[model samples]
Target chain A: MNDTDLNDLLHTAGRTDGTDSFDARADLARGRRALARIRRRRVAGGVLGLAVAGVIGTTAVREYAGDDTPTARQEQQSSSGVEAVRLVSQPLDAGSYRFGKVPDGWSVQGENAFRVTIAKDGDPDTHPDSFIGKLVIMLDSNAPAGDEVTHHNGREFWVNSDGGGDHTSISTLTRDGEPAGTILVQFPNDAGWAKLTMLEFLDSVEVLEGAQPSVG
Target chain B: MRATDRDAEFVEFVAEHRPVLMQAARLLTAGDHAQAEDLVQTTLTKLYVQWPKVRRSDNPVGYARRSLTHVFIDEGRRAFRSRERVVAEPPAPDARREEQVADDHELRASVLDALGGLPPRQRAAVVLRHWFDLDVDQTARILNCSTGTVKSQTAKALRHLRASLEPAVTLKEIP
Candidate 1:
């Protein structure tokens, strides 16, 4: 078919114009409840009940905790640069890590690493604890390239690549105020894929080893 | 945080561009409407979460596109465990079939059939370029393919369409 004919066909078959939103109001309301719940649970759980998975999957899942249970340290608080951010859990020791700048007013809902806190404001449980997102940082040798925002298991995510270049220190962070994990992985930039490092972010890990290194 | 009625402006931003988002979703999903909608939901939810970082970008739609691709790829991994595959078929023929569809339905049937035969990336290459009016380089970035692949796919799509459509045009007209 000619270009004109092809254009006509595509225009007809393209998606229709209309707002397909059916959950805007409900999701927002849920988000509000989430924020409120986060505040109540800031000190709800005791460190005594904290349990670290001694052995994780094929990939090692490390746990970091403070000398005590993962507790909220006197971290800075701010509402800037964070929005709708919620904490999942701080299983890792957060106070012991580097989380960029712990913005003002950001609370630690759960203790370190596994604590679930909210930043700016929102529900701490937007996603299930196990299904929730973690801030990931790895070697950026093979990151994916695109300008599109992405999602998975109801979580939104992204990866950036400039060209066929080699680099290091890539970070996959969620705005939620949880103790992050900084894992390692081999990442190779490829078409339609990122050659993931056989590792995950190892940030915000906490263990009661008395002395632990904190990741930002 | 929670998008309020006060956030009507943000809502407007999303509503105004949903059609294009939906179109992109359709291609990303290979035309599965439900999957496309889920992609949209995930993208929007993330957009809401990082609206500050995303809004600062020159193109929020671009942000959404990358995010949608991320989900699709991640789902490519363990998603088969929980969800049944749609078989990820190519586009069905676009011709309006009245159940008694004729074999010689001209270019419409031919084009769609061609689409079905194409590889996923090749089909994306064609739709993103022609339907979305994206340039070769842009299509490549979206598909994460080389520009050469985009050009090659378009060429391949055209040849197949021509072969299928020319034969249909030479057939008898409906009475």
Candidate 2:
């Protein structure tokens, strides 16, 4: 259409009855909760990511100094006199899933059968960036959870950018070339350790199918 | 601002601008009410997170609108269901309207239908150029493209609209 006709048409097409009432209260409440939830995850993820990176880095340094890393020790024990010497793993529980090797101070916030929100200790509800905001770990029966795949410790994991303002990182736990679950991590823009820490955490996570033993 | 005050201010902002934001989102989503609502919700949530900075900005309204458009464009690519196409058939002419009014609405619907068939960027160009009457430079600023790209996209989109609408509508040649 000519410019004027096209303008008129576009306006008319956008016209609504204006009767659709939005519950600002409900929406605001929902928005607040969602914001809080994101805050928690980012805080928890940020802190946990840093912590894990620190631990892993320290362990690697120690191993390089000729001391055995935890995994290395476990491997040695299995080789020497045992069938399997499981490495000491701390369980971070969310609903029916248990993630082993969570560092201290990180607490599980929200959980369901499929997903769990874990945050660092303190007032994460009020502090959006508390301890690492909140890190979300979820199990998706559907394979290939994220867009990009990268290998860590010889295991393949899918990773992608969520395109959020914080530029959250999404990495999926893969089993036999398929996604078993996902880890969503958000860190401050200046946190150079974000990607490396997230990869390390995903590499070390052990996802159990059912509830944490205590919960069961 | 204190977090509580920031939150209160954001709530006020959403209350004040939700209507207009919903309108733009409705158009961006091609009249899918549910999808439009979801888009608005997501945009508002982002707005809330950045409310402190957004409030200090020169034009909060424009910021909100731009953010809404960006969210729409950004998500439309990643999600399959977010891109809802218009139905094949236009709604029947309203019996309640006078013939002229009904004709007008039908023409508008046809234009909208054609608009729906366009790719997201083309549709955005048409909306910004024809609907909002933005200058090439202004449209470029919103679309994050060069002024020449805005003119080119608007021209191409207008041509598509002309072809689709045919005899009932006419587009002047892009000079």
Fnat by candidate, in order: 0.10, 0.40
Q: How big is the positional error of residue A152 in model 1, measured in Å on the Cα after superposition?
A: 29
The stretch of ten residues in a row with the least summed lDDT in candidate 2 chain A is A78-87
| TM-score winner | 2
> How far off is model 2, as Cα RMSD?
17.6
Candidate 1 segments exceeding 4 Å error: A1-5, A17-216, B1-9, B27-30, B69-113, B161-175
Q: For every candidate, what is the interface RMSD in angstroms?
A: 9.6, 11.6
**Candidate 2, which segments miss by more than 4 Å at Cα?**
A1-3, A53-216, B80-104, B171-175
- lDDT of candidate 1 over B1-175, digit per residue (tens): 3355425645765657666777666654544568777776666655555455456555676666665555554444434322222424553444443231233233344444445555555556667677667787667655544567778878887666555545333222211
TM-score of chain A of 1: 0.20
lDDT digits (tens) for residues A101-179 of candidate 1 = 2323333333333222222224354321111222222222222223233454343334333222322223343334533
When superposed on Cα atoms, how far off is each prediction in RMSD? Answer: 16.5, 17.6
